[model samples]
Target: MSSPTSSRAVPPSSPPSTQAQPAGLWPGLGLSAVAALIALGINHAVPTASALLVAIVMGVILTNVRPLPASTAPGLAVAGKRLLRIGIVLLGLQLSLGDILGLGWGMIGVVIAVVVGGLLVTEFVGRLLGVRPAQRSLIGAGFSICGAAAVAGVEGVIEDKHEEDVVTALALVVLFGTLMIPLVPLASTALGMDPRDSGLWAGLSIHEVAQVVAAAGIIGPSALKVGVIVKLARVLMLAPVMVWFGLQLRRRGGQVEGKRPPLVPLFVAGFLAAALLRTTGWLPASVLDPIKMLQTFLLAAAMFALGTGVTASRLKNVGGRPVVLAAVTTLAVAGIAWSGVMFIG
Candidate 1:
């Protein structure tokens, strides 16, 4: 969590009141918006495809095929981090405490177990396989919670010095999440699972909300409804999990006080507030509908920004360790979630 020191020297006579220039945000935001539009078009053309997935794919292709300008780095960083947090905040509007509790204690317990156990198992497997600790933790969190967003949340706290880890974890999330879209429905049907159970399984185990929705949607509307609620229940665990990681990082020392993510991030608090607002019936249907639309667009943009940070070179340099870790973690989560669903039934 250390703040990066600037190599540039300031003159002793320079005014203390002077501030550094702010990074530009337009380039990144513009690209992200373009990606989102492309994703939207893809989603429209192929109903089963997820906009978020398309956005990320477009980002990766653009970044690798034609490198972005150096000037766009600052804005892309903003799009990746700031926009991501905002999207996560907006994600809260989709959930309510009542909706979660209505799933009953059994389903709630399953979610808790999957999140907690998946995180621990993934981290352990990553470490055992010799992946870097920070990267391992990011992978674990990504699988256990909300995919790239969860990994970004953990990185904000631990402030991993390497950007490669973030990209690697996100790449894996996109890959496995995409794969789950078809596999979950096929497996659920073969197993003769009730649509509700299939939906819950998809929601609890899939890496991203969009992926969860895609998987559940193929199962049916009932499964889609069940999936979203269960997914949000897992999302609710993010704040506490992040706080725990932050505290652990601080205890390890070398953490800069102001640079570290807060124990309860403002965005997480905002998410809770949004959920409460939904529960209160104060937000009219007119307002709620637009906000939901905004949430998808924002997340799609953030995901595109995240994808732009990745490169084929970086992935090659890391070798196959990350892929192996991703595979292990994916299996672990899927197994745990499937077992939980059957046990609950």
Candidate 2:
């Protein structure tokens, strides 16, 4: 028998084998980075446009236009999963308990009610529409919480194969949320809503933060301020909602390769910690500004990676049930928020 040292000798081809794993990540990462940069440039030119939305659209376009090289898969996977988590953790830094509490008890109650109510109504309507459970939950999370980011967060905890569902949810948010940007402002004006109420409605009803901001901006300066604050409040619910989803999955015996998902994912815990840190007012604008930029870039890159998974054929196969469910959920959320604004006023 050979000696232990000889038996453990490195193979002649081991060096390239070891290097290949990391090397494979560069192409896809580079592609995602490029797409994100283009998205940023477009958003900068059209301030009202959402960079995240543009990134995902570009990704889908590229995917349909041509096939990506196999080498890009590793980096794309990193962008979609690891980078996405890091971006979400950093997202917490944008929120502060102090700011949310400043809205006072009445408006706070309305915000909570909107989120909870929207989720329940969406799930109920989705079931009635014959939407798949996974898609229904994803749509509910996206519409009820913070839009595409919320969908991505819920997608992380779900062990089921639901990539198409995630994409569909994101697409729905973009579609309905975009429509709300113009419609909410016009409706607010026609309804004789004060700037504050208009802001509240936009913040409460709109799906994406960017969409809320656009709608609020169209109303007035005061509307912009209140709208952003209210939207952030909704974002604050993401951590708990993600944990709840994970717990639900565990209760149903959802597992990945025989392993149960953690009750609170590490990234989500990090998100909570980041928010707490923000609450302390320790990080100044000097630090926050760069972190904010980095967070946006990472999230945009992740969105691009996710978009690549979408294709014309897959989208065509998705059918119209999800579209109908999205429309109903959008109406449900807008109605609930509108009523809350009226009641609180």
The model with the greatest lDDT is 2
Prediction-by-prediction clash tally: 0, 0
Give the range where candidate 2 is weakest over 10 consecutive residues by summed lDDT. Answer: 7-16
Question: Model 2's lDDT to the true fold?
Answer: 0.83
Per-model TM values vs. the true structure:
0.89, 0.92
Task: State model 1's lDDT.
Answer: 0.78
List runs of model 1 lying over 4 Å from the truth: 1-23, 254-260
Clashing pairs in 1: none
Worst 10 residues of 1 by lDDT: 9-18
Q: How do the residues 122-160 of candidate 1 rate in per-residue lDDT, one tens digit apiece? A: 778878788888888889999889887788767777744
Query: How big is the positional error of residue 256 in model 1, measured in Å on the Cα after superposition?
Result: 6.0
- What are the per-residue Cα lDDT tens digits for candidate 2 across 43-117? 889989888989988987887788566566667767877788899999999999999999988988888888888
